[model samples]
Target: MEDHQLSKSLQSIGKSCFVKNFELFSDAAISDLDAMQFLMDDQGYEQTGARTRVREGRRIIESGRAKDALKIIADARLEDSTLADKAYRLSL
Candidate 1:
Protein backbone atom coordinates (compact mmCIF):
# COMPACT_ATOMS: atom_id res chain seq x y z
CA MET A 1 0.00 0.00 0.00
CA GLU A 2 1.04 3.54 -0.58
CA ASP A 3 2.12 5.69 2.33
CA HIS A 4 -1.14 7.64 2.39
CA GLN A 5 -3.14 4.45 2.20
CA LEU A 6 -1.16 2.87 4.99
CA SER A 7 -1.54 5.95 7.09
CA LYS A 8 -5.27 5.93 6.47
CA SER A 9 -5.44 2.28 7.42
CA LEU A 10 -3.50 2.87 10.60
CA GLN A 11 -5.73 5.79 11.49
CA SER A 12 -8.84 3.76 10.77
CA ILE A 13 -7.64 0.84 12.84
CA GLY A 14 -6.72 3.11 15.69
CA LYS A 15 -10.15 4.72 15.62
CA SER A 16 -11.99 1.43 15.44
CA CYS A 17 -9.98 -0.07 18.26
CA PHE A 18 -10.50 3.02 20.35
CA VAL A 19 -14.25 3.04 19.72
CA LYS A 20 -14.40 -0.55 20.92
CA ASN A 21 -12.83 0.61 24.16
CA PHE A 22 -9.66 -1.36 23.67
CA GLU A 23 -7.28 -0.92 26.57
CA LEU A 24 -4.34 1.44 26.15
CA PHE A 25 -1.83 -1.38 26.54
CA SER A 26 -3.67 -3.43 23.92
CA ASP A 27 -3.95 -0.52 21.57
CA ALA A 28 -0.29 0.12 22.08
CA ALA A 29 0.42 -3.42 21.01
CA ILE A 30 -1.66 -2.99 17.89
CA SER A 31 0.06 0.28 17.17
CA ASP A 32 3.43 -1.37 17.56
CA LEU A 33 2.43 -4.06 15.10
CA ASP A 34 1.18 -1.53 12.65
CA ALA A 35 4.39 0.43 12.96
CA MET A 36 6.38 -2.67 12.23
CA GLN A 37 4.23 -3.46 9.26
CA PHE A 38 4.76 0.02 7.96
CA LEU A 39 8.46 -0.35 8.31
CA MET A 40 8.49 -3.68 6.54
CA ASP A 41 6.18 -2.49 3.81
CA ASP A 42 7.95 0.74 3.02
CA GLN A 43 11.57 1.66 3.58
CA GLY A 44 11.27 5.23 2.36
CA TYR A 45 8.82 6.02 5.13
CA GLU A 46 11.61 6.19 7.65
CA GLN A 47 12.59 9.62 6.32
CA THR A 48 9.08 10.88 5.90
CA GLY A 49 7.54 13.49 8.19
CA ALA A 50 4.60 11.40 9.33
CA ARG A 51 6.77 8.41 10.01
CA THR A 52 9.06 10.56 12.11
CA ARG A 53 6.18 11.64 14.31
CA VAL A 54 4.91 8.09 14.57
CA ARG A 55 8.35 6.86 15.57
CA GLU A 56 8.68 9.58 18.16
CA GLY A 57 5.31 8.71 19.61
CA ARG A 58 6.18 5.04 19.67
CA ARG A 59 9.48 5.80 21.36
CA ILE A 60 7.69 7.81 24.01
CA ILE A 61 5.45 4.87 24.76
CA GLU A 62 8.28 2.36 24.69
CA SER A 63 10.27 4.50 27.10
CA GLY A 64 7.40 4.39 29.61
CA ARG A 65 6.65 8.05 29.13
CA ALA A 66 2.96 7.54 29.65
CA LYS A 67 1.97 11.17 30.07
CA ASP A 68 4.08 12.24 27.12
CA ALA A 69 2.80 9.37 25.07
CA LEU A 70 -0.74 10.39 25.89
CA LYS A 71 -0.02 13.94 24.81
CA ILE A 72 1.63 12.81 21.58
CA ILE A 73 -1.24 10.47 20.81
CA ALA A 74 -3.71 13.22 21.60
CA ASP A 75 -1.98 15.57 19.20
CA ALA A 76 -1.79 12.90 16.53
CA ARG A 77 -5.46 12.11 17.01
CA LEU A 78 -6.33 15.75 16.50
CA GLU A 79 -4.51 15.78 13.19
CA ASP A 80 -5.95 12.47 11.98
CA SER A 81 -9.70 12.96 12.75
CA THR A 82 -10.16 9.21 13.32
CA LEU A 83 -7.70 9.41 16.20
CA ALA A 84 -9.96 11.66 18.26
CA ASP A 85 -12.82 9.20 17.90
CA LYS A 86 -10.56 6.43 19.06
CA ALA A 87 -9.15 8.54 21.87
CA TYR A 88 -12.70 9.31 22.99
CA ARG A 89 -13.78 5.72 22.78
CA LEU A 90 -10.70 4.35 24.48
CA SER A 91 -10.49 7.12 27.09
CA LEU A 92 -6.73 7.26 26.59
Candidate 2:
Protein backbone atom coordinates (compact mmCIF):
# COMPACT_ATOMS: atom_id res chain seq x y z
CA MET A 1 0.00 0.00 0.00
CA GLU A 2 0.98 3.59 -0.49
CA ASP A 3 0.18 7.15 0.50
CA HIS A 4 -2.25 7.46 -2.36
CA GLN A 5 -4.59 4.94 -0.78
CA LEU A 6 -4.63 6.87 2.48
CA SER A 7 -5.09 10.06 0.57
CA LYS A 8 -8.13 8.58 -1.11
CA SER A 9 -9.50 7.52 2.23
CA LEU A 10 -8.99 11.03 3.52
CA GLN A 11 -11.01 12.29 0.62
CA SER A 12 -13.75 9.79 1.38
CA ILE A 13 -14.20 10.86 4.96
CA GLY A 14 -17.51 12.44 6.17
CA LYS A 15 -19.33 11.99 2.89
CA SER A 16 -19.70 8.47 1.53
CA CYS A 17 -17.59 7.84 -1.55
CA PHE A 18 -18.69 4.61 -3.14
CA VAL A 19 -15.88 4.52 -5.66
CA LYS A 20 -13.02 3.98 -3.25
CA ASN A 21 -9.97 2.16 -4.44
CA PHE A 22 -8.29 -0.48 -2.35
CA GLU A 23 -6.62 1.01 0.75
CA LEU A 24 -2.86 0.81 0.97
CA PHE A 25 -0.75 1.00 4.09
CA SER A 26 2.44 2.67 5.19
CA ASP A 27 4.50 2.05 8.32
CA ALA A 28 3.39 5.09 10.31
CA ALA A 29 -0.03 5.47 8.79
CA ILE A 30 -1.67 3.15 11.25
CA SER A 31 -2.01 5.80 13.94
CA ASP A 32 -3.97 8.03 11.63
CA LEU A 33 -6.20 5.13 10.77
CA ASP A 34 -6.62 4.36 14.46
CA ALA A 35 -7.96 7.85 14.99
CA MET A 36 -10.31 7.46 12.08
CA GLN A 37 -11.58 4.19 13.44
CA PHE A 38 -12.00 5.73 16.86
CA LEU A 39 -14.01 8.52 15.37
CA MET A 40 -16.22 6.00 13.66
CA ASP A 41 -16.61 3.88 16.76
CA ASP A 42 -16.90 6.54 19.45
CA GLN A 43 -19.64 8.28 17.64
CA GLY A 44 -22.97 8.47 19.47
CA TYR A 45 -24.25 7.12 16.19
CA GLU A 46 -24.59 3.43 15.66
CA GLN A 47 -23.01 1.66 12.69
CA THR A 48 -23.44 -1.71 11.12
CA GLY A 49 -21.02 -4.54 11.86
CA ALA A 50 -19.58 -4.25 8.37
CA ARG A 51 -18.97 -0.56 8.87
CA THR A 52 -17.19 -1.07 12.16
CA ARG A 53 -15.03 -3.88 10.87
CA VAL A 54 -14.10 -1.99 7.72
CA ARG A 55 -13.06 0.99 9.79
CA GLU A 56 -11.21 -1.08 12.36
CA GLY A 57 -9.52 -3.30 9.82
CA ARG A 58 -8.38 -0.28 7.89
CA ARG A 59 -6.60 0.83 11.03
CA ILE A 60 -5.12 -2.57 11.55
CA ILE A 61 -3.84 -2.74 8.01
CA GLU A 62 -2.61 0.84 7.85
CA SER A 63 -0.92 0.37 11.19
CA GLY A 64 1.35 -2.28 9.69
CA ARG A 65 -0.20 -4.78 12.05
CA ALA A 66 -1.70 -7.16 9.59
CA LYS A 67 -0.01 -10.08 11.34
CA ASP A 68 -1.35 -8.92 14.68
CA ALA A 69 -4.70 -8.19 13.09
CA LEU A 70 -5.04 -11.87 12.28
CA LYS A 71 -5.24 -12.51 15.99
CA ILE A 72 -7.98 -9.93 16.40
CA ILE A 73 -9.98 -11.48 13.61
CA ALA A 74 -9.45 -14.93 15.06
CA ASP A 75 -10.72 -13.74 18.42
CA ALA A 76 -13.65 -11.94 16.92
CA ARG A 77 -14.56 -14.84 14.66
CA LEU A 78 -16.86 -16.44 17.15
CA GLU A 79 -18.86 -13.27 17.39
CA ASP A 80 -19.48 -13.53 13.64
CA SER A 81 -18.56 -9.91 13.22
CA THR A 82 -17.45 -8.35 9.97
CA LEU A 83 -13.82 -8.76 10.99
CA ALA A 84 -14.26 -12.47 10.59
CA ASP A 85 -15.17 -12.02 6.99
CA LYS A 86 -12.75 -13.70 4.54
CA ALA A 87 -11.47 -10.38 3.24
CA TYR A 88 -10.05 -9.41 6.62
CA ARG A 89 -9.02 -12.87 7.75
CA LEU A 90 -5.52 -12.05 6.52
CA SER A 91 -5.90 -8.30 7.14
CA LEU A 92 -5.63 -7.46 3.44
| Candidate with the greatest TM-score versus the true structure | 1
Deviation from native of the Cα of residue 30 in model 1, angstroms: 9.7
Candidate 2 lDDT score at position 46: 34
- For model 1, name the residue pairs that clash: none
User: lDDT tens digits, residues 1-92, model 1?
Assistant: 34454445445434333222324333565665565455446533343533444554454335554343334345563556775555544344
Once fitted onto the true fold, the runs of candidate 2 whose alpha carbons sit more than 4 angstroms away are 1-47, 71-92
Q: What C-alpha lDDT, on a 0 to 100 scale, does residue 53 get in candidate 1?
A: 41
What lDDT would each prediction earn against the true structure? Answer: 0.44, 0.40
lDDT tens per residue, model 2, 9-84 = 3333321211111242223454544544544555433345335445644654555655543443345434435435
| Leading candidate by lDDT | 1
Model 2: colliding residue pairs: 30-63
